[model samples]
Target: MQALKHILYFADGEFGPTQAFRRAVALAREHGARLTLMDVTIESGIGADLVKRFGLADDVQQSEQRLWALTHLAEDWVQGQPARLRVTIGTPFIEVIQAVLRDGHDLVIKPVRERPSSRGLFASTDMHLLRKCPCPVWVDREPEHAAPRQPAQPTDANADPRCIRVLAAVDATQPDSRQLNRTILDTAGAVAGRDDAALDVVHAWQAPFDGSLPGAGPVDHDVQLADVLGLLEREHAAALTALTADYRTRLNGGDTHLARGEPAATILAHADALASDLIVLATLSRPREPGLFIGTTAEDVLQGAQTSVLALKPEGFVSPVS
Candidate 1:
């Protein structure tokens, strides 16, 4: 597996840029990777007018000042680590993607700032970048200050590194699920292998049914309910076991977990329990409708998972049989 050589960190109004910059610098130094810090300033007419009104004579100068301050801050924080600085003015997501492609970066890191609305809509930039970026995207949400300053010590109790943990979330019912599951497993294994960290394979299964009272249907249904649940449980266990068998062999240190409940809730609970550093999930490929692609489980996980998430695009599927 080719390790990420170049990483692009995107900064903007959200507190994420600073955290992304810091993490990128640390990882780059640890991995001998090159780092580029980019700040995207939108040139909307209103934004431009506001900049001018604020006594900024030249937009370029203002941008340069911001970049300089950020670059210096990163340099001082990293303490002589080598990194490139870039500042671009345009649509934030477009600029970041273009930079990634132009620079041939292997990874892109951005802070995930939840939108103020209760609907759990991420900033437009985050959604756009997550959906379209070709390389792996790491969306950090925890405040930087909350993170530990020193690297995690290696011992039997604290053998895992402080670097983010990657959980591959899969829907085992769909035939295509295996492809996504394998991709996530392989990618996550590669990441864990690189850092000598722990990788966990997680599948969230839910009994398919509309919410309804149990006894409302029929007395005869009562006896069949146990059979139905037993069948579902058996199928879920078989699927999880088959999926993990080969992967467990490939990743000697990895572990598999299966949970029965609401998909999002179960997955989040496991992630929280593990204190996962990151999650790797495959996006559902439904028709492009507002809220349609976001499944109930994925929506819940995306909005509520307390760790960073890496959502793989559905277009990357490659069948395992072939």
Candidate 2:
């Protein structure tokens, strides 16, 4: 697998240091990649002294210093990795996105809460970034247990870090399903190549019958609808099964999971069941389709994913934001 060469870590001064920062350092150390620590804070000045009195005065200089306040501690734990700090004040995601595009960072990393937002599924900042960022975004979460206080040696990207179980999320029904599926498999396999970690390929699908189609007679039409659903299931399952068989041979070894329900829920269930470390997926948008496939299912997964998530946009896919 190709290592990430440039990574942007957002150190929102208000949220302070986070697991994403730690993980980004590890990734950078492994790949010897360029790491830029960006601290974004919005400061309005009419009564600047009043804001200072309330301890809310964070200009570029103060924000720069604040961004690195926790770096010494983190660097002590993860040594030999130096990151350039960026301090700016503007709308949070907008500034961050601009930096990514301007500087050509390959990945964006940010920390997220253990539980999803109660108001909706995803944090506003995270959702916004996930939707609009051009490059892949890695959303980091708090580890269940704390590591020992001693500093950790930088690990080789070629070697397995623990059992790096990879979960490749595939949408089989997309217009460009074949290419997207291949990309997902190629990435997961490359990461899991001949290592201690194993890959799990899962395709989440919903049965077509959701009472949307009308039936003529109560009993006879019920049987017909059931047959139609069964046929759809069989067709999809057969195709997925063939693909997984080929993947199993190509990847060396893995278990294929077929989930029947809402795509998001099914993907989450399988990820949790296997305790996946990384989830790789590409966003889906079609002109013929009313809404985005990735918006609902992928967004749901992105919000609830307890592990690191690598979200990719399909080639030639354009964001409406631009």
Best by TM-score: 2
Give lDDT tens digits, candidate 1, residues 31-110. Answer: 78888777877674556677768865365775777687766656555434467888888888888878876778878887
Q: How close is candidate 2 to the true structure, as a TM-score?
A: 0.79
lDDT of 2 by residue, 1-322 (tens): 4578888988655343356666677667767888887767676553778666877644765666666664653455445667777767777788888888788888888876334444333467777777777777776655567453344444533111433688888876666567767777777776566345788988877766675457457668777777777888787788787666667754445577877789878887888898887787765532224334356777777766667676776666554343
TM-score of each candidate structure, all chains considered together: 0.75, 0.79
Instruction: Show the colliding residue pairs in model 2.
Output: none
Clashes of each: 0, 0
Runs in model 1 with CA error above 4 Å?
13-19, 29-33, 44-54, 77-82, 117-122, 143-161, 164-166, 194-196, 211-219, 249-255, 285-296, 315-322
* Cα-based lDDT at residue 179, candidate 1: 67
lDDT of each: 0.67, 0.68
